[model samples]
Target: MNTFKDDTLGSIFFQVMRLHHIRSHTLMGMQKIHRGQPPILGLLWDKDGRTQKEISEELHLQPATVTVMLQRMEKSGLIERRSDSEDLRISRVYLTDKGKQIKDNVEEAIKRLEDECFDGFTIEEKLLLRRFFIHMRDNLLKVSEYKEI
Candidate 1:
């Protein structure tokens, strides 16, 4: 019988997650979406005109980190930051026309990565795994931070 030695279930989970992250980065990088940008772009593409703070919060990224990525993206002509009319201090992120044009392609790249990762999994199995992972995440969260689904 063969077994993975010195690896607990949690360690295996961590390894899988790391691999998933690396795979996602490679897949998205091919489309010129750097390691830190896809999640930000994904959010904006899904619903444009979000505050920088909101993007940071939604993606669980630091505000400073988001700012740096936003700067890079702005330089790449992918997004523009505009001051809020009511609160000039708050900068809202809007995708450029170039960014909008690539949204579908970016989404497709991400979908390809996801589909590749889940290839061969039956729908029932995929659903069960999703439920398990969500439950595990909820278990790790504080009671007040988690809502039952």
Candidate 2:
């Protein structure tokens, strides 16, 4: 064994996040959606036809970034941007049929990943882990300007 057997909390947090990113990417690839699109897709699935500005605010992303992602997703046939008849300035995003099909696929993928990640973990351990993760998130939010939503 190496002298430095790294067991730091920050290291573990990074390892978990990295693993989740990898898994999410693989899952999205299988579903034929971009990695960044799931967050948007999930938002739309929960409430279809949200404007880019609303999405940017809800996801805490820049409007410019959301615009770029929406363009890519629209080209992929996953979403459509429509002009708001009442408010021409605001455009609402709607999911295509293909995008609707992807909802269940990604949900299953997430569940599969969760099961794999938490395999053999007891309920108590899982609860404790969730609490710790939330606490860490709260700490991060405090350091930044983001408030709990």
Top candidate on TM-score is 2
* Per-residue lDDT of model 2, residues 13-118, tens digit only: 6777888899878977887877888889999999999999899999999999999999999999999999998999989999999889878888898788899899
For model 2, state the Cα shift of residue 20 in Å. Answer: 1.7
The digit string of per-residue lDDT tens for model 1 on 14-123 reads 77788888988887788777767878888987899999889877877688898999999999899999999899888899999988887777788888988988999999
What TM-score fits each model?
A: 0.83, 0.91
Per-residue lDDT for 109 in model 2?
Answer: 83
lDDT of 1 at 65: 90
What do the candidate models score in CA lDDT, each in turn? 0.83, 0.88
Clashing pairs in 2: none
Candidate 2 segments whose C-alpha is farther than 4 A from its true place = 1-5
Off by over 4 Å in 1: 1-7, 143-149
* lDDT of model 2 at position 76: 93
Model 1 residue 89 lDDT score: 88
Model 1 residue 140 lDDT? 73
Ten contiguous residues minimizing lDDT sum, candidate 1 = 1-10
- Superposed Cα deviation of residue 32, candidate 2 (Å): 1.1
